[model samples]
Target: MAETSLTELLERNARHVESLDSDHFAGVEDTQAPVAVSICCSDSRVPHDGMWDVTHPGWLFTPSTIGNQVWDIHDGERVVDGSLLYPMINTRTNVTLVVGHTGCGAVSAALDAVQNGPGMVPAGIEKWVDLIVPVVEAGLNDERIDADRDVSLVDQLVEYNVDRQIEFLLESDDVPETETVYGFVYDFQGVYSDERGRAYLVNADGETDVAALRELAPTKYHDAVDRLLQ
Candidate 1:
């Protein structure tokens, strides 16, 4: 198979842009009025639009970064803090979602860096990946993950990191208590009833109770919810 050239890629993109009709954006408003703010990983497979089945442009205030790690680094001067605050300030959004996924390269790289040591993966990149070192360590300490078992520590860290990120956001003074925050895990392995890449609610409004979380999970994911609670 021939590799697609930059010219071909640009032409394809231009064609797509030209094909978009006015009707496609007819319902979109000029003002920033979104239902929720979504913080997710920069993984290509898990696009924010598909998570909420978004059809309109302003349905979600999306901010994606490496591993979707949120922290009070540098006294709230980091990009993650600004990204979360931007939607809250500009949009009429009441819900905040911290989403992570299975098969996340960022989480895996962070796991490797923590287990071993930060290697030559560029100075800035290494710093960003190092943010999840605590998460990786927590996952490693979890009694559920046995070294002899087939469990992927990286996947465990992904879910745990989402919980930690949500915890950080909820504790932030900038985040109003009126706004609901949720932590979710996007399962890409069809683990939830053969539906690939479905968003499963792990934490709702800072509550991680199994029963409360079970109430939020879709009926199709009831079995998966049991596994998550286990």
Candidate 2:
């Protein structure tokens, strides 16, 4: 099965090469100034570039990790991961977008780890999940979250997690205050609304107020900008 999938991948790459124009990436070959640097969960369902309909190579800089975590353990300290920082420092990328999706397996694992004591897992996977466990614990303490409710706990945790990640980004000295951070929860389970696959703006520069978020967005998306926890 793996061999078949690998063959399909090569064939798909051949088709992609055939469809490309001569100058398709010529403009960005030397340098790149992407619209935004997006950090999202390592989920197969979420397409970081496709969400923005970005086909051009240099338009979006994507750095993904488990649980959509911005920080990684390095030498016994949690620091901003290099994959997310390298683009901002060199590519003139200012806008930082942190995207979390509903039904995130990472967040679910963290929730379980927090509630039931962590089960033994691979060390690398445990690192990311361990970071998220505290966020889940904090979310549970917040009045907005409920283990049982109309909105599923996992979905609510996903939104809360997005906000937490943005907060971490904002507080980091490594990240310039001049850079704007936008947090979004990509809804695919009809949890935020009936519109599946809609990326809802939940936080901007640490502001989670729905009214403020609506104002931050274009008038057309005001109704769409929503926070599940609130």
Q: Which candidate's TM-score is highest?
A: 2
Q: Distance from true position, residue 197, model 2, in Å?
A: 1.1
* Candidate 2 residue-wise lDDT, 31-121, digit = tens: 8889789999999899988888888799999989999999987899878888898887777688999999999999999999988999899
The models' CA-based lDDT, in order, is 0.76, 0.89
Q: Looking at model 1, which ten-residue stretch has the lowest summed lDDT?
A: 221-230
Shift in Å, residue 195, candidate 2: 1.0
Tens-digit lDDT track of model 1 for 1-230: 65889999999999978877777666565566888999888887888998788866778988887888765367546434678777876675889899888878888898888777877888767766877777778877887655564546666667778877887877787777678998888888754347776787778877877676778867766655533424
TM-score of model number 1: 0.85
Q: For each candidate, what TM-score against the reference? A: 0.85, 0.96
Each candidate: how many clashes?
0, 0
Candidate 1's C-alpha runs over 4 A off are 1-3, 26-29, 75-80, 191-193, 217-229
